[model samples]
Every structure is written in C-alpha cells, then in structure tokens.
Target: MSYSTLSSRTVLVTGATSGIGQETARQLAERGATVLLHGRTAEEARAAADRLIATTDVEPRQLHTYSADFAHLDKVETLARQVAAEHPHLDVLVNNAGIAAPERHTVTADGNEVAFQVNFLAHYLLTCLLEPALTSDPGGRVVNVSSALHRTGSIQWSDPNRTRRYTRVAAYAQSQLALTVFAADQRVTAVSVHPGVCDTALLPLYAHKGISPAEGAANVVRLCDPAVEIVNGAYYDRATRVEPAQAATEDRTVKRLNKLADLLVSRSAA
Candidate 1:
C-alpha cells in the first residue's frame, strides 16, 4: 500500500498501548494518517501518542490521546462524546481494546461479563453513539478486533450474559463471534479480523500463542488500503485477505444477531 496516499485520513484506534493495536497505530502513523490513540488510562494513552509522534511521519496535530476504561459503559459513552465533540469529522474508528479470560468470570460496574463488555458490547454502543461523526465521513470504516476462534462459538440470547453456563475461553469466543455478526447486522462498513494469534500480552491469558504483534497486525494496515474498503464486511485474516467462514454467510443468523445486539444496546443505554 502507498502510505503517502492515505495521509489525508484520520483514525481513532482503541487499545493502542500494546500488541496489534500498538503496531497498527505505528503503521498508520508511518503512512501519514493522523492517529488518535486510545488507552485504558491517561498516562498510557499519552505515552502511546508520544511514541507515534516520535517514530512516525504522522503530523503532531493529528496525534491525540483518549483514555477510557471500556469495562465501564458510562466511560465508553463519555469517550464517544468526547471524540465527536473534539473531532466531529472522524474518518475511521478501530475497536481494538480487548482482554482474554482463560478461567473464571468477572463483571463490570454495569454487570455484564468483562470480555463481552469490552470486546463486543462497548464497541457496539460506542459506534452507534458516534454514527453521526462516522457516517459523516465520505467512506468511513470500523474495524473490530475479532478472532478465528469465533468459528467454535454460539450465542445464547436467553443467556447472553453467560449467567447460566460459562467458560473463560468460550466467553471470549462468544464476544468475537457476536461482534462479527454485529458488523454484518449494522452494515456499518465494518469488518472483523482474527489478527491470527499475535504474540502479545494477551497471549499469556491463553498460554502464549501465534506470531509476532507486527505480523498479527499486517491485516489491519491492509484494511486501511483502499481496496479493502471497497469490499467492506469481509473478514480478513493475517494476510489481509477475506476468508469469512460458513457462519458469516447466514442471513438468518445475522438477523438474529442484529436483534440481540439491539436489545443489549437499548438495555445498556437505558
């Protein structure tokens, strides 16, 4: 991809402090796009932004820091409002902040499962809240940090919270699977990517797996390529090629997922 040609766009990347998110920010910055880095805390967000400025060709004015702990629904709302208020014309938003759970269950202040809260639900709510700013951009894009593990998952709407049956790994898979379906349902020029087991801190949560963060993020940079935007909603693996599975093609499932995600969004907003 020609980095110089993409310089005119602006991007907001969540979880920019580490792993694929961090490398994505770096690659985008190198390509001359203004990158707004999001971190769980203020200090980390600032540091991530600084790292981009210090190392890439990104303009200083284009680099920004947004700090929000996604586990808190209110914080996600606040972060959304802040972005729209400050940068009313957003070009792309990447929901990349995620956590893995290999054992046990945890709840957020809002009482939802932790992995689903940050992984699928928070991004869903935030994007819906920012629709105006997003769609306002001529050809906007939203990237959800999904996983290949989604192929082995199921969404029990009656027990979306996993209050009845839960396993740490399955919960994570469910979150990613839900996000993939959400992307299809919203038709919001979004796509879910596995990033193919990047070797990042998230690895320890699952006993360390996959390649390096840079390789895991190669698809992210490709998603930004003009060609990828032309074919939105297509799943891309590490090679930046679309490789959606059987479930990704089911309209009935997509409809069901849309209804489920809508219900969850309304409940959270209420």
Candidate 2:
C-alpha cells in the first residue's frame, strides 16, 4: 500500500505500547497519518508516543496518545469522548487491544471476565461511541484484531462471563468469537482480522514460535488501507478473506450478543 493514501488521515490504535499495536501505529505514522496511541495509563501512552517520535521521522503532532483502562467500561466511554473532543474527525479506528489470560480467570471492577471485557466489550463500546466521527468520513474504517481461535469457539450465552465454568483458553476464544460476531452485525464499515499467530505478548504460554509483530501488523495495516475497497463486516485471515465460525454467521447470535453487550455497558454506567 502507498503512504499517500493515508496522508492527512487520522487513525486511532488501542494497546499500542508494544507488539502488533505498536507496529501498526508506527507504520501509520510513517505513512503521514495522525496516529492516536492508546495505553492503559497516561504514562504508558506518553512513553509510546515518545518512542514513536524518536524512532520514526514523523512530526510530533502527527503522533498523539490517549489512555484508558478497557477493563473498566466507564473508562472506555471516557476515552471515546476524549478522542472526539480532541480530533475533528477519525478516518480509522483499530481495535487491537485484547488480552489472553491463560493463567486463570479474573474479573474486572465491573464484575465481567477480564478477557471478555478487554477483548470484546471495550472495543464494542468504543466503536459505538465513535460512530458519529467514524461515519463522517466516506472512507472510514474500523479494523478489529480478532484471532483464528474464534473458529474453534462458541459463545456461552447462559454464562457469558464464565463465572461458573472458567478456563483460560475457553474465555479467550469466546471473546474473539464474540468480537467477530459483533463486527459482522455492525452497520458501519468494519472487519475482523487474525494477525497470523504473531509473537505478541498475548500469545499462549506454551507457544514460542510465530511471525514477527511487524508481519502481523502488516496485515492490519493492509485492512486499514484506504485505497483498497473492502467488504464491510468481513472476516480476514491476514490478507485473505475467510469464513468465521458458524456462530459468527448467525444473525440471531449476533443480535443476542449485541443486546447482551448493551446491557453490560448500561449496567456498568448505572
């Protein structure tokens, strides 16, 4: 893809302190897009922004930082407002912030599973809140960083939080699956991508070999490319289009998950 297409465009990438998110931010910045780098805290975000400026030759104004704890739904809302308040428009929003807690089950302050909240709900809320800004641009895009594990997973509607039966891989897979379903159901232009089992920190405990973060990020950047015509609500494996699991294709489950997500966010705000 050419950098000229991204020039003057504004892009936001979550979990950009390191790994795939960081590389995506760098590449976008290098292409002359105004990149918003998000992290869990202000300090982390600032550090990431500074690193981007130091490493890349882009102007300081071309790279910005925003902080929000995705585990906390309220904070996600706050982050969305802040982005809207600061930027006049957003051309791309990359939901790359996700977690893979393979050790044990942990719930956030909102009483939702950490992986579920971080991997799916947080991005869902953020995207909804930013819909106005996203829709303002004719070529706007929302790229969700999902995983191939979603193919092997199913949503546990009875216990979406996994409170009764918690397992690391199960929760992680379910979260990815939910994200794919959510992307498929959105009215806005959105797509979910599997970053090819990269060597990111979110990888499973037993796995050691995979593609580099830059390689994984290339796939995401390709989806974000404005020059290419993308099929809205499509699922991709790297640059290739692939069918998601059966659950993701079902309109009923998508509606159900969307309603559940709305309830979760509303209850948290209440």
Candidate 3:
C-alpha cells in the first residue's frame, strides 16, 4: 500500500543512486509522491532522479537531488539546511545511506568513527536540523534504516566512539543500535527497519554475508508506506507485523543511549 494519501508529499531518500535506495525512490515516485533523491555525487544523484522520472509518472520538478559524502557531518548539515530551505514542508526522511568497510578504523572529518558518523550521526544531525518541519505535522515520518546486526550487538557505553578499540562488524552493529535508540527517543513518529541479510555490497562489511538487494530493500519501503503510520517507534522487517526493539521499549536504556549521543556530539563539536 502507498504511504501517503496527501497526493503531493515530499520524501527524501539518502543513498538513492544504488541498491535499496534506488528501488525505494522508484516505487515512491510510481505512487505519485514526490521523492528527493540523494547520493554522494552530483552526477549520480541527478541521473538517478532522471531515470525515475523517465520510467514513472513522477513529475519532473517532483524529483530533486542532494549530494554529500556521509563521511562528513559538515556535509550532512549543509544538505539539511539546503533541503529545508528548498522544500520547507518535507513530509518524510528516509535516513538510509550506509557503508561498511572491514579494512580499517575509518573516521569522519570530525574524527568520529566513519561507520558511526555516516550510518548514525549523519542521520541524527539531519533529523535534528529538520525537527521543525517534522514536528509541524506531528504525523510526519522518519524511517531509519538500522539492521538485524544489533541482535549480536550491545551498547558499548564505555567507548561508543571506538576511540580505544574497534572491529568492523562490531562498530557497524553498534552504530545501528545507537540509531534505533535515537529514533525511539525523538518526538515525531519514528521507526527503524532491519532489512535482513541481503545481497547488497553492504554485506562485505562482514566479508562474507550476502542476500539480494531487492530482498533488503523490501523492508525499508514497507516501513515507509502509509499503512504502517501508526507503528511509531517500532522495528519492522518487510511488511510483517511490527515488533518492538528491546532498546526502544526500554525507557532507561534509550535515555542512556541518547545521553551518550549527546555527549559525543558535544565533544565532537568542542
């Protein structure tokens, strides 16, 4: 089922040039909802938007593009301001861009771990900057793309920055957990989806896990569809019945997680 009944809603999708993101943009456009396509490069973002317009009834002006490498929080901030200034009444934000690299302990420009900043912090800052627009409607949706990796992950309160220690899979898992908790803490209706192991290049983060990108994208799109609007703060997979996340369900736990993120961002800014 289509998520928006507004006939003309604006949706922004990150990492939209490839994989699940590309597919979600296509599906959303086909449903007649405007979609803002996001990618790392300008050419790629524009091309992806153009392709969707060609194949779907999406109005040409309805499809927009924003480019930024998630490796830098400055870029995410810039993108948020640019988007908000351009489209003042954004109705949805799919914080879906993610990357996993096993070869090193990557860091963003702010010196935060790469996976933590790109996969998690970038979304956090983006949502915070756009809070006015989201809360304006109260019914606005924020669909966060977390993962099932948290089943094996735990919050490392002592070292979330991975300043002293880091493992590729562990850091990736930790970031997903952090993102889910953050979503649950926000005022607007927010939910996280763990697109099960899919054949996306994202799996190479584990150096072996694999599943088709289509299968991976299924859940992300499901969470965005209007049918699940009442599923605020829930975790979902595909179109299955919604489920509560352990962290989201636990008040004290989510509070702590938010506190940690707050401290990290404060220090990072300092």
Q: Give the count of colliding residue pairs in each prediction.
A: 0, 0, 5
- In angstroms, the error of model 3 at 146 is 1.2
In candidate 2, what are the lDDT values of residues 1-270, reduced to their tens digit?
Answer: 545557868999999999999999988888888899999999999999998888879789888889999989999989999999998588999999987855677989988889999999999899988888884466688999999999877788878888889888888888999889888865679989998988878765327788999999989998887886788788999989988888888888888888888887773422
Task: Indicate the residue-level lDDT of 200 in model 3.
Answer: 72
How well is each residue in 113-150 modelled by candidate 3, as lDDT tens digits?
88888888788888878877763465479988878776
Candidate ranking under TM-score, highest first, comes to 2, 1, 3
lDDT of 3: 0.76
Candidate 1 C-alpha lDDT tens digits along 1-270: 445456777788999998899998888877777788999999999988787778766677777889999889889889999999988877788888898954777877887888888988889888888878875455588877788888877877788788888998789888888877766755478877778877787785445566888877777777765544545677777656565666766788887776676676565322
Model 2 TM-score (2 dp)? 0.95
All candidates' lDDT scores? 0.78, 0.87, 0.76
Best by TM-score: 2
- Candidates in order, TM-scores: namely 0.90, 0.95, 0.88
Give the winner by lDDT: 2
What pairs collide in candidate 3? 3-225, 3-226, 198-211, 199-211, 199-212
Candidate 2 C-alpha error for residue 80, in Å: 0.8
